[model samples]
Target chain A: MSELRTAGANPPWDGLDGSDRHAACMVAARDGDRTALDVLVTELTPLVWHVARGNGLDRSTAEDVVQTVWLALLRHLDRLVEPRALVGWLVTTTRREAQRSWRTNRGQVPLSVELTEQLPTEDWLPEDEALRDDRDRRLWTAFSRLNHRCQEILRLTVLAGRAEYRAVAEALSMPRGSIGPTRGRCLSQLRELLNAEGGSR
Target chain B: MNDIDPRDDDRGHEDAAVLTDLGRLVHELDPPPVGLVERIQFAIALEHLDVEVARWERAGSFAGVRGDRPGTITFTVDNLTVMVNFTSTGERHRIDGWLVPAGQHTVEVRVADHNSTTTRADDGGRFVLSDVPAGTTQILVHLVNSQGEPGRTVVTPTIML
Candidate 1:
């Protein structure tokens, strides 16, 4: 897990911090830098994925929503005035698109189940055969036990990283000041759940 | 900095550690479908920025039965609609396309990693593009105004063949 902390230690955008790197990429992408645009797409896609999946969309629908969001971004590339707001823009757009897709899909599949109940199964990738370890399973079980809001917050904060907290807060429609505390409380709760699971085992 | 509570700092550190682990776990458990980024990059790598992007209306056949039967897909943008019926032709593919509100417009089949094929549609809005080497593909309809001059272009979302 510690090795994961160094995963992006040497980002391509030198000198700039995480959020600033995204901002710089956005500016470059808007200016028609293909490389920068690729960077932006690769970097923020995880956050977008979480947002879409968090909204209770099945895998295929989530994939379509993700594609639609990126295409929408390209259509409005020049119109995005604030490069710093890129994450928020993407998050908000993904949420809206996911909701739309969810409503559309509801026509085909009867969705009487709660959104949280659908999360674990609908969002689970079939290729996650590697998630076999006991600790990972325990962690995932604890994570699934969380209410939808906490899960959404935790996933977004983790993927978006600490630097883009403001954008994430705005996207989630929470007061900017409360994001940190809420995230802290969520992490604490997850830890408690993990401890409980471990004790019962 | 010294006035900051050490307990708060420790808590923050613990939260950071938990987040790092959680991030890794989430990514391992359910990452984006493979090559999604590449697919998007291919889709948005348009030659013209001012074109209207067409939304995929419906696909007629299952991908598994592609070569066995002619697969049809329709894309629409505003009043204009483009539908393509494609079939695997041995080593290549054949595409029969129709554009509604028929006119003699230029239709280009953009294939990734291959030279794009361009052909003009008949006044009835029917066109054919043959020998298209299959990979990822999109369609571009160059509208011609009443004066036979070029108008706004309509681009379709990328589809894998």
Candidate 2:
């Protein structure tokens, strides 16, 4: 089955970017629409998990951190200043929680630098049984060869889907205008790495 | 709102193809674990949500736990803290927990909104919640004031038992 949901078919709400999606959901949620909240959680959990995992947390730990972020969001919903900033809010919050989990795992009492900390290298998407195909494995290896910033930018762009550059900027402190350039550079670098490795047709 | 124009990105079709491939590969590598949506659904059903969030700590857990292992976790909010012990009881879980500093409070183990069970912590802060369905559950510790109005409420991170 093709996994391209909302790819060519622009639904009435499909044109909305990441934050806009969250904003629309938030509106429904504030009106006591329980289903809307479920939509928000189901759609956004992948993004939150990616943010936490990209910080180099192991699978279980990343799951725990993402759970914490959702719980915290529940407690702070009314206090949210900008409902439209939900993607940015989730990104920033998930990162901080991931960092806290990272620190606690290392027995640190205080959280380190917010944005620039290097997490202990972890097998995030460890070789899973589902990825036994040779080409998929090679693609994983090739993708891993990119620097941290490139990997993050690519994943963030995918999560943001049609590019809410502002939400992307909030997730990783990049200049909004530079996201396109960075994405281009990173994709080229990934392509070169794959070619040099002679893997992935 | 600044929107993205793939056309304005000035990218060759090859780059777009690569992004598509990468997205498919990553999604296949590790999709969000099943039951994640159900778990979040249970987590957000706070009747009174303006309560303090008790950040969680994996105080203790058994390694390689699968079928019938006991596990414990701790969550803290302000000076208040709660620790829950889970013993797998077939398809359900028996939850025994305690409050820090030993105070009298009401502890509620709620699965969804209707299947809620409440217990009172004793003077020594011990409480037991039984027969909770082995699914996503949120535990709330509420201290009520003189007029029976809730004063301080501490909640655990949504936990899968």
Candidate 3:
């Protein structure tokens, strides 16, 4: 996998980083091109969704948060001068909105906290209906058992889209220059969990 | 600087492999809901949406004194704050709302997977959308010139009505 990633050595989607592409799309959308805005929405929807859901919001609330972020961005997009700030801005907004959902329904149990209780140890992929194989199912179970912070970091990495370690600093609030070591530790933790069962069904 | 660390590169490879497995696991586990893209597309595709995207400030619902009636939901955007009270009459839902800093503008109610309704606000920034079927929905405020070209537009997130 690493070989394939580094084999090209050049980033995909034209060497423009994720933020640059997003900002460019925003500009085009502003110029009356609906298609450009669609591109922006498509590119960032996953990132925004994961940011909300990964932080512990249920699916419905997470989707709400994502839509809220888009609406907010529509108002503030022109105010954002630098393009690179886009990802950081979107992730932070998602987290804040998800927290708002929590505050609104204080009586409602948080999906993240109630997760373990809702799903017994045997079923880790409860959120997923299409579990392809037993090996993946085992890995998911171990993953679900990860602490919230670890789960958050790994999930953001999955959505970074070749964003480099700085995405950790920007998205996860990790200190600058420490994402490499932090990611290494997090991965080793998962490796330990997977290897415990020989990573098989 | 000194020579590149071979162990560091090897660890990088290891981390990528682990993350790949992690990605596969999570993607399969919590898949995004179907039709998310289309829903967002419809919400974002207002005739004059590119004018400006309104930022969400705060939202809350307050119950009545007796608690027997449906609660009122208040949604605040940067340029406007909308307070919606829902009442069901016969087979249709009624959404009575007010806009802040307000004047008459076209209020469009977007229902997910359902038809939308448009209403015109009064001089007091108040409007009532009557005979609307209840479902998951949201609102958009549009300002149009005398020539009928749209000006600034404000959008709210899709919510249940």
User: Candidate 1 or 2, higher DockQ?
Assistant: 2
> For residues A120-183, what per-residue lDDT tens digits would candidate 3 score against the true structure?
2332225544667666766776676665445656787765533432333354433435555555
For model 2, how does the per-residue alpha-carbon lDDT over B1-161 read when each residue is reduced to its tens digit?
33332334566566666677777876777567787767766777677765777777753232223235687777777798788888888888888998887777899887754478899988888998777787667888998654667687777666665
Candidates 2 and 3 compared: the better one by lDDT is: 2
Kindly list the per-residue Cα lDDT of model 1 for residues A1-201, writing each as its tens digit. 122122555434545645677787777676766667777677677778888776665556566667667777876778878777787788878767665555444544333325543444323433435677777777777776675556777788665554534345344434446655665666777888888878313
lDDT: worst 10-residue window of model 1 chain B: B1-10
**Each candidate: what lDDT?**
0.69, 0.68, 0.63
Clashing pairs in 1: none
Model 2 interface CAPRI class: acceptable
Which parts of model 1 have CA positions greater than 4 angstroms off? A1-14, A105-129, A141-151, A162-174, A177-201, B1-20, B57-70, B78-80, B100-104, B145-149
TM-score of each: 0.72, 0.79, 0.66
Candidate 3 regions with alpha-carbon error over 4 angstroms:
A1-20, A107-125, A128-132, A161-176, A195-201, B1-14, B47-74, B77-93, B96-106, B111-116, B120-127, B133-136, B141-154
Candidate 2 per-residue C-alpha lDDT over A75-185 given as tens digits, one digit per residue, 9 for 90 to 100: 567667778777778888887877676566566543454332333223455774557666666667777666555666677766555343445434444355666676677
Interface RMSD of 1: 5.7
Task: Report how large a share of the reference interface contacts model 3 reproduces.
Answer: 0.41
B9-64 per-residue lDDT for model 1 (tens digits): 45766666666777788877777888777777777787766667676653321232
| Top of the candidates by lDDT | 1
DockQ measured for candidate 3: 0.26
Off by over 4 Å in 2: A1-21, A108-122, A145-149, A162-174, A177-189, A199-201, B1-14, B59-67, B112-114, B145-149
- Kindly give the stretch of ten consecutive residues in candidate 1 chain A with the minimal lDDT sum: A1-10
